[model samples]
Target: MAVGAIGVVFGDIGTSPLYALRDTFAGHHPLPLDQLHVYGIISLMFWSMMIIVTLKYVSVIMRADNKGEGGSLALLALINQHTTGNRWGKGIILLGVFATALFYGDSMITPAVSVMGAIEGVAVYQPEMHPLIVPMVVTILIGLFLIQSRGTEKVATFFGPIMLFYFATIAVLGLVSIAQMPQVISALSPHHAVEMFLADPFRGFLAMGAAVLAVTGAEALYADMGHFGRSPIRMSWLAFVLPALVLNYLGQASLLMRNPAALESPFYFLAPDWFQWPLLIIASLAAVIASQAVISGAFSVTQQAIQLGFIPRMTIKHTSTAAGQIYIPVINFALMIAVILLVLVFQRSSNLTAAYGIAVTGAMLIDNFLLAVVLFKLWHWKKPLAIGLLTMFFLIDGGYLGANLTKIPDGGWVPLLMGIAIFTLLTTWSRGRALMRQGMAEGSIPLEVFTKSAHSSATRVPGTAVFMASTVAGVPSALLHNIKHNKVLHQRVVILTVHIEDVPYVEPAERSTVKDFGNGFYRLTLRFGFLEETDVPAALRTVTMCGEAFDMMKTSFFLSRQTLIPSDKPGMALWREKLFAWMLRNAASAMEFFRLPTNRVVELGSQLKI
Candidate 1:
């Protein structure tokens, strides 16, 4: 899992040295290979990794799991769990959801930038191939996405060894150059970083944002921790990945110092021309792997988003019976199209690099903010340690965010546009859901009254009937209609509300809150961590522990499908309100989300105007 997880989490950051060194030198500042610039860049990279990756994430943020899962949703769930139904919790939930929305933008751009960057080497080696780059890339990208339905288990097996070899090759190439100029190692000093900034304060600061591209996928490390476990990721980074990355970077700097003309793709130039083509092939393969990692990540994140209710559930296919083997066709195709378009428009990795870091860095900044809340509020860490760690991470992340801002005029507008579009969609969907629920509640009977009236008025049926409600306190229209239509109440009634808490993972203790409503009727509120996937049928199986055996054949699950009544409601804009309604109509049935038996599932429709 660590090997597989590494290819997913660290690929973006891992491949950064490919362009980071070149971008920093020829970036907005265009600094010379003076000791200060070299040392400053090295120092900044090291400490950025230390604070952002090592301290904040590995040491602190990973500790705040929602059950055993960790990610934006997981952290949000933790805050939600502790804060309960409070305004602040709502705010944190929005922040977390927004962060998640931004990740979609990152996911789209990562493949575009990485693949473009690698393929551009073709131009460097054979300029004639430049004309074919976009087409070639498009073809490969389309093929990659098309195969997603088939699953990546077999393809992923080679990812570890290939990435390991790539890392080793770069490290060896870098070390060879560094051995010739051992003084390059001294650039690790913080004073050099300070001096470079002081000498060209504005440009240096702007460059930090582009430099941030080097660590774009840092958040994925934490998001993926559940897949690989903290120990494996931590050990891999400390023992192997980090050291190799540093050595290669230092070697690149050493070569840059000796041959100032090597600024054109220092990564490839570090190797002999004879090896350049082979290096390009190796690098391109690595880039493709990096892109695949993010693509798969997008699928996983989308699944969580749908389950959590911030987004409408779309058709989700389980490509494998294995846990987390989800394939969301809508999201996969959407990303594939965007990435192909990006490659055509940006044309080169250097151009797309400007658009890359902003979304990722913005997401990373949000991760730090949420981590702070987790450390102080959830983990109950002492004030000093929490504050210190938060401050360190914020400064490092802030520096990169500030730098990336400079690229806005030079194509950085891509991610910004992408982020705004995604954020709006997320906010609109979440707000719209709330308003729709409010409208539905206005027509719902209070649970207490419904229980009293339906007990005797409704005819008795032979088996169990489970009604899925948005809220536990309100009676679902499905239940009301079921009784009205058949005039039959089951021998047992279960009002099950699946609450997608705004957290990453849910602990076992917080799994279900059960209340016996008397007369063989039960209210079950199942709480799931954002990290844990929700299965309705599986949750039903646990009702026995609450004093009821779940008989599948005798059980019927009911869900209310809310239809939209577009009106002059003083809620959302007319256009957005209509869009929300359309989305609701298209979302996958609640029966699927809850893992309910398809044959026993029942859906009722009710019109809502919000």
Candidate 2:
């Protein structure tokens, strides 16, 4: 598990050694290639990992996992469970959604930048081959997304040993350079970082933005907690990942002290001449592995958003028995286009550097805020201790965010724009769903009243009719339409409502509840964990209340297909309502999403204004 965690979770941070130092020294805002800056940047890089990744994420945030799952959406669900309807709680929820939105931007950048950084090494060995760098990186990214449909179950086995070898190789290379200038080891001291900051406060502060590159994938440790347990992730980081990154960063600094010319490509220069080509091949492979993690994370986040009603339902294909290993083709294709475009636009990893940290720091800042809420309100930590810990997080996270904001004009606006677009889509879907529910409820007749009034007069038919409803207490629109047009009711009527719980899994014993309404009428509420798939037929099999099990031939599923009309409602602007309508048109049908049998299903259409 530790090795697997290292491969999957730490790939982003592990690959940072390839371009992190180069960016700090030769990027958009190049730092001085002198001993002071070298030691200082090295010190800042190490401490940033300690404070942001090790202390904040590994030690504190991982404890807030939602039933072994972790990520912005999981944490958001967890926080929503603890606090609801309050102003501050709503604000936290928005921040969480925005953080998730920003992650899409990160997802696009990671593959483009990481692979480009690795491929750039080819230029060091065969400078004439530099022209192929962009094309090669694009090809690699295309291939990565192309294979997502078939799943990673087979290829995943090699990830662990390959990444382990990558880490070990970098560590050995770093140690060799560090042996030449043992003084680089002194960067472990906080005094160097402080001295560097004291030398020129603003410049050193700006350096924080670039230095953050070293720990870019810190959040993955928490995001992937479900895939590998917290203990294994922590153990991997503490015992292996963290030390290797620190040594590599320090080694780059030591090598820079000897040869400033290496600043253009310190990571590849650290390799011996004979070893550079093999190292480049290894690095390119590792970059692809790192890209795989980010791509998979995008799919997971999208699935969670759809389940939580923040986004329209997309087709989700489970490619493996592992619950965490599903694939979303839409997300995969979208990321592929964005990443390939990024490779063309940025052309080099150093150019993408300007766009990288803003999203990461923004998300980290929000994570700290959510963590504070959990610590104070949920964990019941004392005010003083909570305030103390939170204060520390604010200082670090806020500082980094402020530093990264300086890059906005250069290229950071790319992520900010992407994040805003995503946040708009999410909030729009959420608000639209709520308004649609409100409209449905406003016109809805009481279930008991409907059954009492309609059942006696309507012609009774044989077999069971299952009406899917949004609310447990109300009559489904499909049933009303059926009664109005056909003037008949099934002998056994089941008004079924599916509820998505915040938890990851609902045990079989607690999966469903049924209440008899008398006279062939019954109300059934099916509970599903957000992580669980919703299959009406499968869930119906667990319901033993009615006589005999549900037979597909005799069981008819009814679904309400809502046709939304834009209106002067107070909820959203007319433009947004139209946007929602368009989104509604594209969303997967309820029957498809719920895995209802096609031949046994009946859809009744109704118009809604919101």
Point to the candidate with the largest lDDT: 2
Q: What does the lDDT read for residue 151 in candidate 1?
A: 90
lDDT of 1 by residue, 398-450 (tens): 87888787788988888888878887777788889889778888887778778
Candidate 2 regions with alpha-carbon error over 4 angstroms: none
Q: Estimate, for each residue in 425-465, the C-alpha lDDT of model 2 and write its tens digit.
A: 99999999999998889888887788789878899999999
Error of 2 at 45 (Å): 0.7
What overall lDDT, based on C-alpha atoms, would model 2 receive against the true structure?
0.90
TM-score of 2: 0.99
Candidate 1 residues lying further than 4 Å off, grouped into runs, are 27-29, 33-36, 85-87, 381-385, 455-461, 490-492, 501-527, 545-554, 567-569
